[model samples]
Target: MNTLYRKSLPGTKLDYFDTRAAIEDLQPGSYAKLPYTSRVLAEQLVRRCDPETLTDSLKQLIEFKRELDFPWYPARVVCHDILGQTALVDLAGLRDAIAEQGGDPSKVNPVVPTQLIVDHSLAVEAAGFDPDAFEKNRAIEDRRNDDRFHFIEWCKTAFDNVDVIPAGNGIMHQINLEKMSPVIQARDGVAYPDTCVGTDSHTPHVDALGVVAIGVGGLEAETVMLGLPSMMRLPDIIGVKLIGKRQPGITATDIVLAITEFLRNQKVVSAYLEFFGEGAKNLTIGDRATISNMTPEFGASAGMFYIDEQTIDYLKLTGREPEQVALVEQYAKLTGLWADDLENVEYERVLEFDLSTVVRNMAGPSNPHRRLPTSALNERGIAGDDMLAAAKAEEADGLMPDGAVIIAAITSCTNTSNPRNVVAAGLIAKKANELGLGRKPWVKTSFAPGSKVAKLYLEEAGLLSEMEQLGFGIVGYACTTCNGMSGALDPVIQQEIIDRDL
Candidate 1:
């Protein structure tokens, strides 16, 4: 509590708060058994907590006692356009209220670094089949949300410590994973873990890089933005031991869907999960990110992986500076936050999952946690009994029949952030084109990847043209369908559903 230990990085002028020193001081040799989350939380408290109360707070984390509350000051905040805009609007209102109270309105501003990406406002009105779908959809978005865009543009200049990524750039989560987050941040001669709270639940996507990011509501995020600690008790930490390798041709989506079903059945709601073991070690950062992005769907507060080689590789692949990447590795290894160092870390409860048990699958009509194997679609009453007859009837009637897919989109950060998943989709499209198969006329299909880099890889693989030939052309980079922005259905199709009470 009194002058927590600090040490300089070897061969560098920067320094970091020695979390291990603080832990050992509280209880000798206690740092070795602390979980990765606890260690990071402890460092933050030691650096930010009041000197008088710091010892008690460190005790709560060290002893794993949840009876008392502790304060957590996240390093940053991330958001999408919808909630970020609303939060700023509220702040604007607060400024006015301060003026009415004879206070300086201009003094109100965000206390932490805030990044807002304009991703949730666009819709997929122009289907991939259209020749100018991307341009048409973007035009429609601008026409419809001109006033909103104006306000957002104003917010960039009006706000302090806020950065805006304009529309048509990419989804917030993907951008954060690929560009924004520095695994180890150095500021004011001090290095610390990069932790944040975002407006969207999938913010945990960056947890794959070993950064502690959690999704919070606008109000809670506003509290953090105003430089207030998020009071909390230690959560029930559960260790998920992933064993065995996934079968060939299996995607991260399949594995996550299976894990979601298993975890939900195990009553893992509101728990913090740390995934480790051989299976986790084999997974690429992209694969881990796909699983982390689905954290909220599995009803868990966080799904974390310890910092390791994969984390360093991803940082390099994403074009991070060499010095920063080195800092991440050095800091993690020195503080025992690396994956190899966590083998002896203890947890209150543990769950084991086998990756080989997962298969090709998709989630159902409503729940993301419900798993449905592709081979059992007919047996499960999802596929129609007579496909040929239905097609023939629709052809004769000169109209698309009921049960025709109105939207088939690949838009969310969940699968798009993983190159393997995106590449597989491209490969499937190529094979389908070669086999003389095309999308159904009534199906409005689009491929809105979360990052521009995805498009680069797909093109380099010589699969983009194949995908486009099959009516899976690139749409806007912003999120579609997942946020209820799937755009308008054809009037005839809308009428048909209405008439049939579907």
Candidate 2:
């Protein structure tokens, strides 16, 4: 019997089952209609469920039943430096606690493979225009993070089933999307899909590959890391239909900023956003990656695009060996995971976003959903001769300006996944330098690519020198400014702002 059963406390109704039999025994051809996420859940349930009550539990998803609790076993855990460091710290504390009791401290280790990438620690202390900006900024990072780094290094040898990808490597999400996650994982004589829970809110960036990656809070990741199942009900799956081609020069960042605003307005929080239609099909995996990477910024749990030729193309482009790529293609096709296979897939709710309508945009001040059009900068009071004059006057007086651009950085997996944005920033920097439009002296700028590949491409394009000329040098490959580790401001500038409250 390929069934599993469990009994919970009174009033609790979580009976777990494996999906293998559910797919075969439920309505014929129903498994193909399930989302990739559901398929993964099914695989885990079948493998781990006890033999007594499998079908009863499988009937819940297969029949759209919603009243039961199911166990989901993610294949692994991925984490960024800030949260990952904190997580390990907690575990160390737990280890001490466990040792105090009769429990063995060494016995407390991650049950599944866990990868902790050291990113999110550097901050831009120098503008991109400085010739020694990269070296200077790195020095500051090492000094500031000595405490965190010491603890992290200890974690390397102290924990079992945990791997540390050292800092100055790249952003965690980009590294995972590019090099870490094998679309399919083979272990212990069994082959299964690769699904994971990451500490940051943007862990879903790798979802572009049809993986069921979701970002969870550090607290939640701790639970999963300790071998507890993430219990939750079925999410509202929302289909976002994209249409029309983007206008020339429109970056994926621009589109995602706009889409993020639109989708949030449409209320997609905690929903699974499935990008479909012609616009999605036309998008390169890089562009798709840019969108999926912002899944958290848009308040969705996962932003998934169907696996298709583009997905295959990206695996090859990123230099994955042929055999692995072949396995991905073969498995996806055989398992009905291809884009064409999901054409008839149904969703409870759907919305539309037009790629053609998107324009160059930036998000922030305080929120990722706050999309700001560059054209509206003057009208929106973020740009204007008056503000510029005030800023210049403050500079003349040796005072920091109101609304000064304190940090202008190129960081985060959201924007870093696309080479276009990186190249664009470099090109703009080059043009600005040629035009004598240097960054305000108060602005701290840095460039931290998520992978070494970006450096190669930028150098090949001859834009690295231009970036350095503007003081946007590589500040060690890491998440840097995006994770709130924007390095210290110039002491003088910081004092001026503090003294004057500017």
Candidate 3:
């Protein structure tokens, strides 16, 4: 409240609150021992807390105490269509109630910046085998969601500080990673870290860029949207030290699936995990994002990485301005938010994971955390069965056979947001085409990247045609299969499941 420590950024007109100075003033030299999370939280308190209560709140974080509650006001709020629409509907209803009580209905609006993306309504109604699948699926989405679209359109004009990205654009998480977050924000002459709370569980995907992003339910998001602080006790901050490099032929997806299993087994529920060490530093921002995107699957509140060179490279790759990128690097180093500065920081619990131990894996059967090593598929009796003869017989009898794959989609921001994963799928499709291999008759294969930029890169690499030829063409660019919007199965396949109780 005594104007908490302000300093002008070097070579810029912008100024930022010196969170470290304030902390050091309270308890000399304490800033050096604070973890990255604690430092970020401390900045918000210094900027927003009341004068009388500020010391008490900062003490809780500084002493690593979890016995008391504190308040967090995120910098922004993001939403996908499903929950975003519902929250807007609630706001509209609240306005009606206020008007009935003789208050101004027109005065109701969001207090913070809210970005609503229409990504959840589209389903993959048409399979990728159809050349017009993208167009057809988008048409179906508009037809079915006409009323919702109308409401969303109204909210665009009726609200303040709101931005809407229409359907068929991209998934919210991926967009946030590519463009929405600045990593370092300069507003009203002050620079601060970019932090947000989104309506979807995968919102932490952008945390890879060193932003403090977390997913909240609609009600909780509403509270934040109305400018109320999200009260919380200090979370268990777990340090996951990644040692050794990943073995060759291993994708980020493989490592994340393995990490998901490990973290779930360790019972990391409701904790904030900081991934660091040699292996973590070696990973690309795309790889870190893949892991952060699965925070919900691993039962962690946030999967954070320290702001470092990888963060700088990603901002440039995503086409951020040079000045902004320079500002991010300068600000991080000056404030001890950089990874190198966190080397001696201590955590309540530390877990070491050897990355070289990871192998190609898939999570399934029922849970995302149930990792199954691809090498052990035959050993575990999940493959190598003699179903070929039975499948041939069923096909000859004009039935969609047993063990048929109803959907084989490369959907979701989970994998598609990472270029390496998308390129890997494209390469596989290309190799399959060269070998004259094709998808089975009953399998519905589709490639739905989280952003159009993926298409640009794939085409530049000349892998788009091969993917399309293999029945993995682009579909609508929204969350398709992951949101239970996989669309209708073929009539025969549907009947078979119905008749057999599958």
Strongest candidate by lDDT? 3
Candidate 2 segments whose C-alpha is farther than 4 A from its true place:
1-21, 89-107, 384-402, 495-501
| Regions of candidate 3 where Cα sits further than 4 Å from its true position | 98-104, 388-399, 500-502
TM-score of each: 0.96, 0.89, 0.96
Q: Model 3, residue 286: what's the lDDT?
A: 94
Worst 10 residues of 1 by lDDT: 1-10
Please give, for residues 211-264, the per-residue lDDT of candidate 3 as tens digits: 999999999999999998999878888999999999988999999999999999
Q: Determine the backbone clash count of candidate 2.
A: 15
Our model 1 lands, by Cα RMSD against the true structure, at 1.7
- Taken over the whole model, the C-alpha lDDT of each candidate is 0.89, 0.79, 0.89
Which lDDT tens digits does candidate 2 get at residues 1-502?
Answer: 1333222212222232334445776677787677656666666767665546556666666666678777777888999878888888998998999999978898878777889998777766655566676677677778988998899888999999899988677888888888877786655544456789999888889988888899988888888888888876567778899999999999999999999899889888888888999999999878998999988777889998877898889889888888778767765665566788777666777798889999889788579899999999899898999989988897788777887778878877777778888999889888988998776677887877888888899999989888887878777687777777676788988987888887
**Candidate 1: which pairs clash?**
none
Clashing pairs in 3: none
Per-residue lDDT of model 1, residues 311-429, tens digit only: 99999999999999999999899878899888888888889999998999989557988899998888876675586578679768876766667788887899999999999999999
Candidate 1 wrongly placed segments (more than 4 Å): 99-104, 384-388, 396-399, 500-502
